[model samples]
Target: MSSRISTTRVHEAGIETLQKRQVELAGAQERLTSGKRVAKASDDPAAAARAERALAGEMRAQTSERAVEASRTAMSLSETAMGDVVELLQQAREAMVAAGNASYTDNERRGLAEKLTSIRQQLLSVANRTDGAGSFLFGGQGAGSAPFVDAAGGVQYRGIAGERRTEPATDLPLTINGDGVFMTSLTGNGVFQTSAAAGVTQAWIDNGQVSDPSALTGSTYTLQFSIAAGATTYAVLENGLPTAVTAAPYVSGRDITVDGQTFRISGAPASGDQFTVQPSTATLSVFDTLDRAIGQLGTPSRTAAQIAQGNTDALRDLDQSMSQLQGARAAAGEMLVRIDSETGRLADQKLANQSERSRAEDLDMTDAISKFQNLQTGYDAALKSYSMVQRLSLFQYLNT
Candidate 1:
């Protein structure tokens, strides 16, 4: 097949070869400049798709990081506020203890009451603390304004009763429940409450404890004392029904066990004096506890027995409020710990996403530069060959 090649065909073929080489060189230069293996979907469809997915994952990780930051700020503020609340409650407890000193005059007790009132106001402020962005730390889910407000009855929580969380893959709390922190504490000893009858100044009852959890019936119990025939005796009544311990010898400051509860009643009691014990199911407000203690301390006409009873009850209630506040603070601390854990996890996830994106689309600089140089050399050689072929003529070739 010895066919002579035409100049027109040769010129067209040489031009096409140069154009193809230039295009390849340009593509290599573009890749090197952009530092990306797949600049567009046309370059590598599968690699581009993988890079897109990785980029989306990176964005999500960034969003989660932002959420975690917001949650951390809010929870840190809340935890600090809870700590302040605990400190204020402890101060109130100290004031209550000072008020219990029998040597303190009525005026001295009133001064302690004033101190407690101040602490109460401080506690309310802590409960309504903000995140510096017009949001409350203990606002629960949400609130239009302040969460806790001082009303005529006492301090009340107006916020929702649950926590608010950040919006991201890692859900984190932004607020704590004001109601749980400040309103919903158990009364008395957390099991049962004991109280002397009104006008029974001769005797006082101590806060009772549970002796046997299985024997508890949650029934109301009444202890009636009788001074008959020069002997002191007491009778136990369970929900107004007489028990087998009728006319038991009355001993002052002796432990009296009924059902599953145990308590002590000190001082002499006249005939028909009564004390009641009931289950501690009632909710006690921290503010109400402080108010009662203040009122008791401010009263100057209370007998010794009455004062002792008031002190006992006030201390018990204060301890309960402190317990509740401590629990809430502990919860806030735990939330902060969780936030830290989530932060570390999100950081690792973000790093992984970045690595995946780099693997999918990022160019290897060393390999890319070498390939670009090779492409440049090939394009230059093609240009030189085209020039030499263009100079070739039929007469010059025949003379040679």
Candidate 2:
């Protein structure tokens, strides 16, 4: 009987119960104040691990987004630079057309040539455009220096043949090649240059270009000049076979018309002098064509025939260059569209990841507050009961 109602044992039980209640109350208060269900891994290890993984994914996505943005900026700059190039090429083309005017004196044509030189320099500057980080845009994985250099009286491409891409978005090509944009070669056979035959030093392919590419047979033709009874005549041969077309009288300083083409011969040609008219398959640089135009304009006493030929060649090369510029611009525009689309995707993905992380670890304020109030009521009741028990005697409840 003494053991069951022992005063010391009762006091010890009361104190232990009160202490447990107090600890529970304090823990509840902390949870309410901090507003986090899982402040540490010990609180909820699985939830903490899930939140950590989501956060890591979100960070990676953000990094990729930054790279995409950088690529977009670079592509925008490339398009702008190419646009400027097209404008300059147009200006050069107009100058070439103006130089062809027969009424313009040599001095006036010289002014046009000077203007062309300026345009070429400006084009070079445009081609050597860089990103915000100062890396060359068209360097094609080469050194950061200018890809085009003035060498041997013409511009040369020092960069590699292809473009370099960016990290994180390796599928996207970020840069344009220098050769494709600024140094396109001539089309057709390698006859961009013309030379007079051994005996016919004065006759050449003056300003000769294929006016109509579709009409070209790609066959070599020969001009055989014959002196019949002191009257000069020349017949064209298609692969050593003479056509039914009769030999026409040769007149100095006049154009000889053949197969929708014309040739002007000023210097005297002896009989049996042969001239070959072959299509050019070799490629020439755009800058070379510009230089040729300038050189033609600067030439003193160029006949109307020479001016006409120069006009045709310059205009053709300019058209080709403009076409190439448009192609490059289209590619850049496409890349911009892709970047924008992918950026939208990344933004959506980041939001999803954040939402997952929040669900895993964020506190529920309503539940936490209710739990704190319950623990507080329990703690107050336990304190009052412990104080009463400590003062009560063994016979108190029986007497009452």
Candidate 3:
């Protein structure tokens, strides 16, 4: 069956076609303007989520990069400071050698002592060094103030024994403890320092070097010498508890091994003379070592033997101190390397994340422009076709 065609229906269809073309043109315009393929979440939810996650990780990497920078600065400062300590100790050793010359008078020795005193003060200043923000560098966890303080005999370490580490990467420690750098003691001699007990004048004591550092128990020990059976004998005490039932024979020029540490006793001693041994702790003050050097080289009326012992002990202690500084410098260098490596890794990661995010969210400008032009041409063709269709009539088509 044939039905009559309505002109209104044709015009309506043409209008609908124009409207659809207009919507397409609007969407193409939006993409070109915004420079993003998915400006709205509904455009591509999964792609949006991927881009968001990548951007978040990039932010975290940027934060870690900042931390690495700070760690690098800190490590640099530590390395330089340790270098300064090494130089100062070397100077002190050279001064000790000069003081040993017999040709130098007592006044000359006093002059050398004054120089050493100045050096000790300088060492104290170094010990109390601070970072750029005025925080103590060697304060361990106690960064509030100076770590070393003035005490009765010499300077003492007032800082806590620990470290502050930075996490530039997961589970990585980027800082070293101050105790490890400042207070490293090996076993042999100087396991404990020696001094003449109160009310005793028959013997002079020198703080020996550590021979075997690992076996020390950090306990207090005492050595008391007495004359028995026409021989000098000494008793050992550990923390005020008797270590032996009877005194051991004191032999001159023999090494006394106690608690895995070896100490030497030489020369004649009076009855009731005593010496004490204090266990080495995890930390030692560079200033204390310097102060001892100054005292040893400065004191007047020191006998030749006493002077010789002091020089020997000072040299040994200074060598150990140098080792400590070197170790610290090496540690700082290693941390610097870690920071640099991590920073490079973070930079590369950020670049990759940026690329990923771009792929997920950013528009391809060339493709977007091309699409806009194509849609514009299509819209123009639709408008022209719609105009032609509107002018068409049933009689006109039948005649053609």
Index of the highest-lDDT prediction: 1
Once superposed on the true structure, which residue ranges of model 3 sit more than 4 Å away at CA? Answer: 1-12, 145-161, 167-180, 183-261, 276-278, 364-370, 390-400
lDDT at residue 348 of model 3 (Cα atoms): 93
lDDT of 1 by residue, 1-400 (tens): 7999898888888999999999998988888889899999998899999999999998998998898999989878877887887888888878877777778898998899889888888888878889899989888899989988888988778899998888847878888888887888888799998999987887899998999999999999999999999899999999999999899999999999988899999999889999999998648888888888888888887888988999899889889888888888888789889989998998999899899989999999999999889988988998998898898898989989
Candidate 1 global lDDT? 0.88
TM-score, candidate 3, is 0.78
TM-score, each model? 0.94, 0.75, 0.78
Q: How much does each candidate deviate from the true structure in C-alpha RMSD?
A: 1.9, 5.5, 4.3
**Alpha carbon deviation, residue 338, candidate 1 (Å):** 2.0
Ordering by TM-score: 1, 3, 2
User: Tens-digit lDDT track for model 2 on 45-126?
Assistant: 9999999999998998888888788778878988899899889999998898888777899999999999999999999888
The per-model lDDT (C-alpha) reads 0.88, 0.77, 0.74
The best candidate in terms of TM-score: 1
* Model 2 spans > 4 angstroms off: 1-35, 168-170, 185-284, 390-400
Residue 252 CA displacement from its true place in model 3, Å: 4.5
Candidate 3 lDDT over residue span 1-400, tens digit each = 9997688987888889889989989998888788888787888999999898899989988988877776777678777877887887888888888877878777887887888787777777876777676666777766566777878977776777777766626323434456656655542243565555655433555555567667778888888888977998999888899986257988777878777666677777778777777755444556666677777666787766566666766776677777777877897888788778888899999999998888999898998888889988988998998899887887889989
Deviation in angstroms for 249 in model 2? 12
Local error of candidate 1 at residue 208 (angstroms): 2.1
